[model samples]
Target: MRYLAHSAHAQLGSLWLSCVGWVLTAMALGLIQWRVWLVSDRGVISSGVAWVGVWRACFNSHALVTPGFRVMHCRSMSLAETFTPPEIVAAQVLMLLSLVLGLCGNAGGVYALRNIYFRTQEDSPVRLAFFTTGVLCLSAAVMSLVPLLWNLISVVTNQTIEFPPEFNMPPAPDSQHVGCGIGVGMVGTVLMMVSGIIFCTYRFPVRSQRPGGSSSPAPSVSHSRGAAVNDNPAFESHEDL
Candidate 1:
């Protein structure tokens, strides 16, 4: 059976608190981690791709080659190098936006949850706070998705980089496959979406009342009092006298 929330300020409060965790999880997974993983190149010995994050590219030596020690080589990527066709800057911009929005959403959720928890009497104010948190969370989740989805499309289309006919030096096999970072980002995205769903399910309840006043008037007992007076024999005799 489905139940609806009515006059549920507390429900909104709890939803905001949950939103905070989801927003943070998504941000941490999607924004801070690498962009994608690169398949290990069989042609290369003692070396594999380090992990390609949005801002940098790196490579690592296998443990068998260096035993007991790990080494990684990395370099920062410029917009020209990172994006294919060089003119496509949407991915970069969307990624930056997601980071900012995620932080804002997380902060908003924390503040709203606090208001709901600490100041139960402030119904209107607390309700507003929680609603705001929910909106922020929902928006942040959307913003974070742009980069992840963009990357997925690119990987599936094999469009990470473009090569001219004479560019030579065949592309590395590792570059052909999508990386682990994409999966991590997707997981984060799912968490954010779940938070949004929870918030949406319970919202600021509307007070139901008729324009004239209450839907039903209070019951009257005057008729019962009159009946008792009529039934009293002494009162009837006195009236007749």
Candidate 2:
């Protein structure tokens, strides 16, 4: 019992690391989803494919059910069974959907970036920021699945009934994998947040000038012609009439 308790204690720290990693990853994904929704043109009725829709899709999860907020939290708590028997079929479906969206969104964004660079010799600060953000969110999303993958493998192999009491090997670099994941997730989250700030601050230049404003000097006229029109007796009579 003493050894089991000690094993559980050591494993609990790793569990906490997994929870932290998923939480950070979730935050990034949520931010990416929000940004996409914020900038999408509702009237167009199409995803922002011509722009950075692919990048936006990297974190979009509106239709996905697996690796969702609820499932992640439950699993992080080591309550997989308590959450309706894993829902393997449903989970698989959601995972496939997520994978498709993630791939599409990323591809679209990369293509857009290349198109912009080749067509217009200009780089938009906002697009760069958004792309950076999307990449970070994607990284986080991938990391978020690490614990689930580990657990799934363990279950399939029948290595341990309870993760908390098993896999308590002695301290080593591999043992700190969970910690590294959490750290990387946190970094990704911070990058997304900073990118969000940059995105918000970077604005496109407005085209139309103000009503009374001029971008160039007024054109010059022939002074003699002006004088003739104003001073000629014939023109003066016409003006009077």
Candidate 3:
């Protein structure tokens, strides 16, 4: 049980890193937009895409477009492998969390767009487009939950259990699963970052008024009327008269 738990934990960690890495890659790509404005280098665009793809693959399993090249290797069991129940639970939780992140991201993206429409009539097209793209990417991230769910089902059913002397229950090969996960994570991360950049660049920072400044006071109706009376001496002369 302890060995199973330990192995499961390691798998979870690996899964998480793969997803995060892909997302980061996507973010880096979105950041590329900023680079266009900030950097004047020649090869930045091509390099940025390459970097994004590489990182995306690194971070998430699903992003791996080609998994036929995975090398076969022997492995050993760890201490946590002994605790299978908790391990299964942990896997389910992680999978659920990923799905939630995707849904939340999409919802937030829509809200941001609505806010932009209501608050600012003059919004940049670039930002708006990116916001839309971000929502889609987040949706992809949510789709990555499929394999995790499958893994959970397998664990619950005790399908991985082995018997007798060679009771070592090794982790099943997960190349396809991991590849899909990485891809989804990358797409989601890219969209999210793009949305962020769009919001930041398009939305002008609200400046606060200083406590005491030389700026003119807001004109009030009463003040205006008082000034009118002052302009017309007849309106105020009754008291003096």
Per-residue accuracy of model 2 over 1-241 as CA lDDT, tens digit each: 0112221232233223333434454443333121111224322212221111101222222332235353111112222333222323233333344334344434434443343333443445424533553453344344334433543443344331222322221111111112232234345434433433332343333444546786565778666877988878899888889
* Candidate 3 structure quality by residue, lDDT tens digits, 1-241: 0112221232233234334534553443223111011112223121222111111111112222234433211122232455333333443344345545544554554454444444434434524643553544444444443433444354345443221223221222111112233344345444444443333333333444656753466666555776888888787897478
lDDT of 3 at 64: 29
Off by over 4 Å in 2: 1-112, 120-178, 206-213, 220-241
Best by TM-score: 1
Given candidate 2, what's the lDDT at residue 180? 30
Local distance difference test scores for all models: 0.53, 0.34, 0.36
Show pairs that collide, candidate 2: 54-105, 54-106, 55-105
User: Any idea what lDDT model 3 has?
Assistant: 0.36
The CA root-mean-square deviation of candidate 1, after full C-alpha superposition on the true structure, stands at 6.8
Ranked by lDDT from best down, the candidates are 1, 3, 2
Compute the lDDT for candidate 2. Answer: 0.34
lDDT of 1 by residue, 61-119 (tens): 44322333365444444566633432124445655665566566667656655554454
Candidate 3 weakest lDDT stretch, 10 residues: 51-60
Q: What lDDT, from 0 to 1, does candidate 1 have?
A: 0.53
Task: Provide the clashing-pair count of each candidate structure.
Answer: 4, 3, 33
